[model samples]
Target: MDDARRTAAAPPAGPGTGPGTGPSVGLDIGGTKTLAVLLDAAGEVVAQARLATERGPQGVVAGAARAVRGVTRQAGLTPADLGGVGVGVPGLVDPGPGTVRHAVNVGVDGAPLHLSRLLGAELGGLPVGVENDLNVAALGAAHLALAEDGPGEGDAAGVDLAFLALGTGLAAGLVLDGRLRRGVGGAAGEIGHVPVDPAGPLCPCGQRGCLELYASGTAVAALWPARTGRPAPVELFEAAAAGAPGAAEARDRYASAVAAAVRMLVLAVDVPAVVLGGGVAQLGEPLLVAVRDALARESAGSGFLSSLHLPERVRLAPGRVPVGAVGAAVVGRRAARPAPAAGDPRPAVDHQPA
Candidate 1:
């Protein structure tokens, strides 16, 4: 989503690395929609499908199946030899067993069973692993950043990485020492619902002024109407860019809230690098410059949170864009690897079904 910041010494793969030649499919399932990419073994997308999200849990699963089938057909492969399928969904996901503990927006609770358990048979027994969408996005970004900073064909660099998704809510995925930390019950990076302002506004979780309401795309849209008669952030951004009085005012408020969000994330996480992704990050320079300035002004004037250094890896995502589905697919490869054997090199990716 961060097109401008993505440009770097590392460019995305050329047009040749599509389906049947790479890792197969990367499926990202969101609260309102689902997308899938058919990649060859080379990790390049051969075909992609975006499906309108449906209501009802079964309807959502059915929609996902439809997308999977669409991409498989495009790739000219049957489900039988399709390596593996990775699904990235919102909510708490257990990476150990690839179980979906809960998907609040997707509407499942108390571990409604693993999607892989039921869909496994249909997917040619391919390893169907589920993961927290943000975690997968982090993996994708990590791979890109590693490739960008390292020798050609980006191997994991030693740098720790944090990927933040700013959408209807806020949350982050962390990577250190080339490994992802899926905390206890898989709730580590679930920052969006965390209450940041206890006395401000009521949140879905019965808290006041959660980070989501103040720093997400939803937050920006909510402030849009007050600044300009229009309620759309995209329109509001354009208005601000054009120097429309109301739009500029609304953006300033949004910037302040977002800066606070950034401060909390950077100061607490203490990572050397952080990359911003999601629909809201598309605001481009407005967000980039505002955040950089905010952190500078606030951090320089304060002693607390002053210990965190200016990040070396604080650019936006690369041109290919960071999508949870691609992240999920990459994770599928990792989860499928055989358990570490004595003295064996780490098998980072596995295409065979579990």
Candidate 2:
């Protein structure tokens, strides 16, 4: 919006066929796997690739480089044809230097991994930007939102939304006025650690009754462990549908806790949308319906809450896209482009969900 970020109204001549004028590559590096996407100049994901993530500093860099090449090649391009590369990984990241630390999931710790520089070198010095995994997911979600709804008239800032990830642990990624909010200490959108009940069970963060303990995927597993080796969320929902005793109640309780998370984000940031993502979200419509219902029920008695349309604000992340990888591609595009003045346009894909 201000610096190192600008969206194009129209794409270049071809799918990033020239230096600094072609498609960009984005990588979402997780502990188990690395997902990659090739975002063409038209803002569409032209190709994608997935690879087993090699751990440790060396493996991460090499794996990321390989992912970039694989995705680009899938698009019939090469690293040289890419505008830039973007990486999203778990842990603390200083985007300025493209360095990451405390990324335990990727085996990076203590010493900062100069991921951008290292990966850039591996790929012939192409510009590479590194960002926190959650932040990139938020970016990717925002990109999709803008694609669905074109930029508002006279509104320099684009979409306003929060990406709530109910994975193993609960957390959120904030994209306010079309910009990623990393917060001062990079703790923005960490609503999972917020304590709700003073007398509840203790959390790993030393808080009692933290929101995560109630709302996360792990919480669902605890509430209804897999009796048939299927995921707990699926089993719980199926059982509830079949009138399993207490399953319905447990499901509703979990939904209410997630609804609380949505409420907190809307109250704090008042983002117009809250994209439900992460593992539990894989349950799709069931999960979305449950959370929306909980929001409606919890706000029933409060006129103030009803006026906010909190339930309407909740939606599932697009099932068709690898959001994290797409967001990383956006980062890569930003790295390749010059910073436009504040309020400049940003990328928006033209393709609809396939």
Candidate 3:
């Protein structure tokens, strides 16, 4: 794939019009790397690649531009010969302003993303769109989480959705009444740093005991120190599965923290199904079963919630882990649209950034 990536399409030239040709570009700027994919209107990946993120905003932007250009070349298309270019980042993004208020890994803080400008300067005026990664994941889950046409059709249709990303950081996105909520500051779904343990450990937010302190991928790495440790998280989970006592303790600690976080989510967002994603969520059924059990017991006002048809079923997302990026594409191509009609349940995803 690496060698094959050497051959791809060039992003569209300027701004051109034609029949729908799928999202012109979809870039997911991850903490560790910047990833971009080009797809046709049919949601098929024409080209894709990942670039190692260097330090500072300039480096990040340059690396990202290279990725966008590289993938575009692979697809034999220009930026103008397609739909919108959607990007999903890792920080508190002010979608209205395109300002990444602060980003730990991407080396951006209060930086204006003027993606249109980036596209103009970097890709010859390609129409670019942006969104936060976690929100994109929720959008991704909302669309694909629905059961394929089946006997449970009505039940699936009426279901509300939510998702949590338990990766390096903790964050969630909520889709209510069949719509994505970007919230006032565009951080509505970000409660990961709400201090679940005030007196416990210090959080990346300069505070102590943030929910993420106990539940995120970072937390897992911290909790199970690498060298002196039995092994890293992946190995630890394996050991736990094999009935290693030490691994069991580590797993329980992780589960307990996740349970507390899950309880908070159940109470705050009354969605029907909570889909878990991200690196840590890859534990699959073990994580879900633990979370489900915790919610059944620790979730407050359980009886009341059960009465209100709340405490939605907790489940794992249906697709591959990278679905979050796909969600980001949806955010650009569909979810960012206007609100649905009063009684309409399907999302009205037409607002593809004018």
Candidate 4:
């Protein structure tokens, strides 16, 4: 099997399943769809389900509850048979209270939606934790990395990496030293708004020539609209492969920008890996190669950059699995575990910036 296929089938890692803990369920709740997964104790995805997401506070809770039930049922189990559920949502999330606000796409407005409390109540009191969508994806990527090259020695929490999402927008999710780094105000990975061109077009975030303008999937669409009405990235890559007009240049420019994002992550946090994710990552190997080539060019002139091994650290996110959902399962499993006693040898989350 190819590497992508193998990575897809590889089992994830989390705390072992013990008495009274069957499996964990995770949900990646988007504006249009809710993707759910049932992860067994061994970290293999046993069952999965996708359902149309209903809008509003009550709809969000109801949809999430139904998705959890549906996925668990597909595995011939009920919520009672599961350990816990974790939810990933896009918005300003106060994980402490499991509340989300400003999730306009999901029809959630300024009023904080009590997602965890409501979803848990809907699930007959199953433990539920809600987190930012990108953070869960980062966590999911870190969990998946256990089967990659294996974690570093003395690293017990999990792999340390960055999950760079190249979807409609360009942002990243960071897993530093086996813990999610949400930053102090939960804006840790908002790299898209970082202005790289002072004279470039104005961005909605009030920046000119923001990195998202050059790197995101939306940028591809704006750069090269598909005449065939397919995804712009698909069309652009196909055209470039066919040696069509100006396609390769556009592709390289996009890849170069993406490489910049990778450089930013590695240079700042010095993560060992940067997993390419989000919608555009569906381009697969071609996207990987392009970014690697760009990184090669970037490092060729600077021994300092070369020492970081940027290209070697880049990899595509697992293709077949819902990475965000798998991460939600990891979160759920961790939430169900009891706090460690005093003087436990395990490491706490290091909040100091790198």
Candidate 5:
């Protein structure tokens, strides 16, 4: 039940004008922890907080509500001052009804949990939006890509980026021509479950040789102990770096699997950039270099693959910020905006490459 809070002073700004005019809160709910960030109108983070996630649907909602309140209080604001709250859940979500269809890692599954309504109630009916965590994290990563490269806001218009998260599990967030693409069933970017080996380890999703079993942090941590008598994935990496027997080969296989995933994404969607993220992405440049080297090997053997220049397209999520939380904040801010009428002309889809 312990919680931690941190605050930072925002530059002088006047009170927000309406539901979509003020600061917003973004919460990233993971299997092990929940992170909340308060972002002002211009997207600068004003305060942040973290807490252990509670088990079950109701506990998850309560923990999130507490996180929101704690961060706002730290920032010297209140729910009334917020534009809205956005949450990124690590599971299936039907955003239309603000329901979480399943989030097994957090103990929610089989039944729809009305997450937004519960969160709104906690915030005195302030607007709330819930979406797949990877999707929003992709949004945040795309925004960072745009900011790093040039001037336009990273909304669905200016950035075409793919975010590959290598966390406890693996998945992707796709931002194409400025829009987040959640396929028909909201499962467009579930790349981790893509079958890669006919006889690989079994995935919780009832498949063998899924990519996550080989590339995710969970997978690496699990495999390292069995193969090298190591207790942690980090130690395995360290051992590999020191040229320990069998470690380098294992590391290479993991990297190759990840590279294969990236190649599949680029070949299918033609995105210009792939941003590597998630907890495992903390491996940073070494991981990126391994992926790059693997891609290079593949491309050297196939001209078609080389034509895509996959190596140059890969980038790491920016190391300086909490991208998932900031992205959830962005989603929350957008949710607070008035929806466009049915007959209104929608923004034209951008066709530019990432």
Candidate 6:
């Protein structure tokens, strides 16, 4: 019915039955937009929808419900036919409590927002999994990486990957051996708050010189007004490409900070690859080139750093598909699947991030 729905081949049946046997929904809630993707059993997207994000906790929850319904309707599916729903939010999430601890952009801070309860009620008790947005994006990235490399034991085993997002904020998603890692307190990849300089700039997190303050798209746009009397990140990048002095300096600094972040991640976890995603990642090859050059400069000065091969590990995520939404779908699919019985010898399902 709606233009957003396009017919795709039906997914093949697998281990499950009943409502959980059909397609699942994945929702990615960002500061500005919300994306809903209907994913078939094999994780391929069948239909999708998008809407401007609503402000405040209630509005956000309502918007998410509408998105789910919109995509399912487009895909010719009903709530009862849905397998599960997975949501990715931008702030701190406690999966056990099903709450978003704080997300200023969506107007929830300090006060816990019970997103799962609200969304679950709206969906009439559908199984829902909620996780940090970047973490699910990491899962989606890992899935893409494995898909491109082909299915094999060695290909799927010991797969260590990271998804770096550089949008309004900077953070990472880490997947170790095909499992998402949300460290103690569920803040493993909050690399944006990592102190990069003592005298750089103040961060809202009550820290000075945080990595996000220098490298995030928000930071870049903030610098643009002072340099070119405009506050647009796109214009800033354009100016840098056109050789504007101030814009060039700002661009180079952002690239250097991102390179530093990559180096830190590599030295810390030594993931084999890092997929760059998020709104800022739309800068594409130019941004990738800048980061590679910066990493190269660092490796040139230190033999220890050179051994890390940072440039070889960094890559831009596919810009065409919404990685976060796709990852959330994977999360929902896993959540809906029945757990293996005791002594079944199959690995337990891991859905920590959301």
Alpha-carbon deviation at 49 in model 4, angstroms = 1.5
For model 5 the local lDDT of residue 226 reads 44
For model 1, the stretches where C-alpha displacement exceeds 4 angstroms are 1-22, 54-57, 107-111, 150-154, 157-159, 193-198, 226-231, 302-313, 319-322, 342-354
How do the residues 234-299 of candidate 2 rate in per-residue lDDT, one tens digit apiece?
Answer: 999999989999999999999999999999999999999999999899999998999999999988
TM-score: model 6 vs. ground truth: 0.85
- Where does candidate 3 stray beyond 4 Å? 1-21, 43-47, 73-76, 109-111, 146-159, 197-208, 227-231, 296-312, 318-321, 334-354
TM-score of 2: 0.90
**Per-residue lDDT over 202-287 for candidate 6, one digit per residue giving the tens place of the 0 to 100 score:** 78999999999877888877777645565466677788999987888878777888898898888889998988887788888988
lDDT of 4 by residue, 25-45 (tens): 888989888888878875567
lDDT of 3 by residue, 289-325 (tens): 6666555555454666446432256778864335565
In Å, residue 158's CA in model 5 sits off its true spot by: 3.3
What lDDT does the true structure give each of the candidates? 0.64, 0.84, 0.63, 0.82, 0.80, 0.78
How high is the lDDT of residue 287 in model 3?
Answer: 73
Q: Determine the backbone clash count of candidate 4.
A: 0
Error of 5 at 290 (Å): 1.1
Better of 2 and 6 by TM-score: 2
For residues 1-354, could you state the per-residue lDDT of candidate 1 as single tens digits?
A: 211111112222222232223354667887776777655555545566666665445655666666667666655565555656778887666655766756867766664646765555566566676777887788777766654553444345354677877777777888765677666666777677778778988998788878888878888867775445553667777888899877777877776666666666666666767778887777666677666666666678666646664433356765464356666666655544446788865534322121
lDDT of 2 at 91: 89
Cand. 2 Cα-lDDT: 0.84
Tens-digit lDDT track for model 5 on 156-241?
A: 46577889999878889888777788888777888999999879877899999999888788877765774555435566677789
Q: Write the candidate numbers in order of decreasing lDDT.
A: 2, 4, 5, 6, 1, 3
Q: Candidate 5, overall lDDT?
A: 0.80
Total colliding residue pairs, candidate 2? 5
Q: Give the Cα error of residue 49 in candidate 5, in Å.
A: 1.6
